[model samples]
Target: MKKTVRLILPVLAALTLAQAAQATTPSRVVQGTTELEGEVAKLGETFTLGKQSPLNFTLLKVEYSVGHVVIGNTVYSPKAAEKLLLLHFAVHNPQRRDVRYYWPDLKFTAVDAQDRNHPYAQAVARDGTTERLEINLKPAQKVNVLTVIRVPAGGGVPKLLVQREAALLRYDLRGQVQPLPKAVADPTDTSGATPLTQVPAALKTFNPLERFDVRLDDVKFTGEALNGKAPAAGQRYLSAVFTLRNMEPGGGRYAWSDFKPMLRDADGERVEYNGLLLKASRDETAGGTLGAGEEVRVRFFFALPANVNGQTLTLADGTGRAYVYDVSGVR
Candidate 1:
């Protein structure tokens, strides 16, 4: 009887150990948020706000506030005075080089208990108290940045979804919700030096003065592609081709809006478009995202007076930096 009892006790001990291991086993969840610990640079683990330290950079603390006007020591408000959800995070940069913190690239999405997704809110502060999410950090620089999100009146605990280089970091708001104020617009002034109003004497097929890896080439005057489409009473068509090359390894976003096109005739009078929608008249830079290591060809059409001898294509970057291309006497 003693020998039988000893064998039975060993079997019970083994079963108890198995059950304890199963209960404490961690589940590996992806994308969605979960509790994480220790170094997760490559582990792709989720971290609780202000709890676990990050391997890349420490996430010091997390704060949340709701409503339009959050008044305490200083007012924390954003534009429109609409209901908003704000998430303040303290982050440190442990890299050697300077890192730029941009809110758009962070791609933060908030979800409420009702299974509703609230995207990041676009807000401008009235007194400019809140810093723009765009920050340039030096090595070992620690900064506290906040993201404003437009949320509904009363949503229970908010859970945020954050993705970083294929890793997911989830955060739930466990703080107080505060009010914000309406945003005010920043004033615009034109007190800077005037742009160069002269076209260059020496012109070539392409100019090398491009800020964004784009070249202006194949500029000439041709009525052959007019296809019998008559110009206005005293107007003529001008054609120019733009070639954009992505210098980076990844895809680069290029838009025509980056180049504010303005044409000035020999009389220095600004010329406008003639609404010519020819087959080649479509602006290639319109509504297209440039791919990496890819070359894009875009053509632009401009209408000018027939008697215009010399015209200048003035491309400005809206920051006082202007590049003028001489389009006079193009064959």
Candidate 2:
């Protein structure tokens, strides 16, 4: 048995190496026209991801131009194709000693109006050896690790946010990437739309219809950097964060195997959304049901341009309650 196992080990290593080679160089950095291929998309555009995005599946890839990519599957409306934003993160391992880093596990966290940390996140955890996950980085070799963020329907935020606290992605380029600093959110990004202070206001003031329940002891919102500020007159896209306490009350030992979010435009235009910011899916409501004093939070970012407006938010509860608030920008 020992001899047989030894013989198979070599074959296994060869197979693993082959798979890695096939995924090498997921994107190319060439000086040319501005165009995206396949299901990759930019803001204010339409695209698709073919059939690669299976329900609850994750995608991992490395790029040479961009450094670190994180786009959630929850941020799409029905009009969006499966593949939306294909982010590229340029990476390099320019050292003789191989190193590794772990991308922190994405969670569903809640933020208060003051950008204070709110409890309640998705039941997901990351596996690492110590400070970071083990990734074998060869000397002068680089690769992109692609992971998929899946959202079935009502298991996410209106908009999923991608950020780094202390350059979480370690670049072994030895200062080569100095000029090309880490990507920061500017007025161009969708995040800069509002500040954290507005989270409580967005929830309380927007709760004109009481779409949300008082059981929610936790509530919060997040602001995006708006480098590309929208016209104060034209239609603009928008989003926010939300935290719920003791949600789904009156249900016996419950779970959300089939919960989905509901979205609408300014003119009461309902959008067929899967989920966003955090992502909403049947599994999000899976495992167990909401307890009496449990609280949860999720970011909500969607298209609420200056012209087209939506003044209400509603949970798919039997009461048919709605939350209305005064939003910035124009309608």
Candidate 3:
């Protein structure tokens, strides 16, 4: 009788331990709110996952997916046509906080007909979509946000970032996400980053860039600079350009709207894209501006950590209408 009683006590202890281990994952029982924890586990005859501290309640989960970038055949003139590259993204934030955070300054860059890294406009997903969720937390929450990227999509462009996500802490930008592909020769490296290292680049999209026609020669690009880093991952500064010249001066300055831009590598994968985006200011060196029919080179400089995936200079633009151009080389 004594031996049987001792055996029962041991079994009961083991059962308690098993219950604790199973609590780490989301289960059918925890239907209202889900909690994710980063834990440490030691493997011996048996394994036990030890819990560490949890992150801010502001963040529950950030999950996303890329779809595709659709191209159109319509032509808008010169530097004012549509180079629509659809970046389909789905972001799922399952937290209970109305996250009020400053936005990171991000841009989508791509190479142009001249094989230069040009930047483009900031893109956004349609409102009221499952992918466009911006909410205040109520203890338990789950929301999905999508971003539609329609920037410059073309050839010779090494890479393009269809969509982007920004992260930060202590009032400083921490990380970012954009759409980019690996180069075949060095498909694992970002400028100098290791392929195995998960250095935050941009978000990878399922969709591809769609090509279109627009005027080239009659339009020129001057660089613009900004203070705040790109809203996307690991950005330092934002540089962009406005129209430099139109053969007839003001002949075709305001002929288009919805200007878009992108960046590509020598191998032609879009690294970044921006639509309706703007630069940041810091009092004295406030953001720069451009004027139509104006021909002067403008550029703002920024940097990325040497060990992380960095940003290179690039350019592109479109009006989302009909257009054409005759481009001259500038190198």
Q: How many backbone clashes does candidate 1 have?
A: 10
Tens digit per residue, CA lDDT, model 2, 106-167: 22222222434322222211211012223555665544433323221111123223322311
True-structure lDDT of candidate 2: 0.32
C-alpha lDDT values of all predictions: 0.49, 0.32, 0.29
Candidate 3 C-alpha lDDT tens digits along 151-256: 3332223333221233111111112222233421124334311121111222111111112212222222222233333333433333333323322212333221
Worst 10 residues of 2 by lDDT: 74-83
Worst 10 residues of 1 by lDDT: 185-194
Roughly what TM-score does model 3 have, to 2 decimal places?
A: 0.22
Alpha carbon deviation, residue 75, candidate 3 (Å): 17
* Top lDDT model: 1
Error in Å for residue 101 of model 2: 64
- Model 3 C-alpha lDDT versus the unseen true structure: 0.29
Error of 3 at 151 (Å): 3.8
Task: Report each candidate's C-alpha RMSD, comma-separated, in the order given.
Answer: 18.7, 26.6, 21.9
Better candidate number, 1 or 2, judged by TM-score:
1
For candidate 1, give the lDDT of residue 208. Answer: 22
How many Å off is the CA of 212 in candidate 1?
2.4
Q: How many pairs collide in each candidate, listed in order?
A: 10, 65, 85
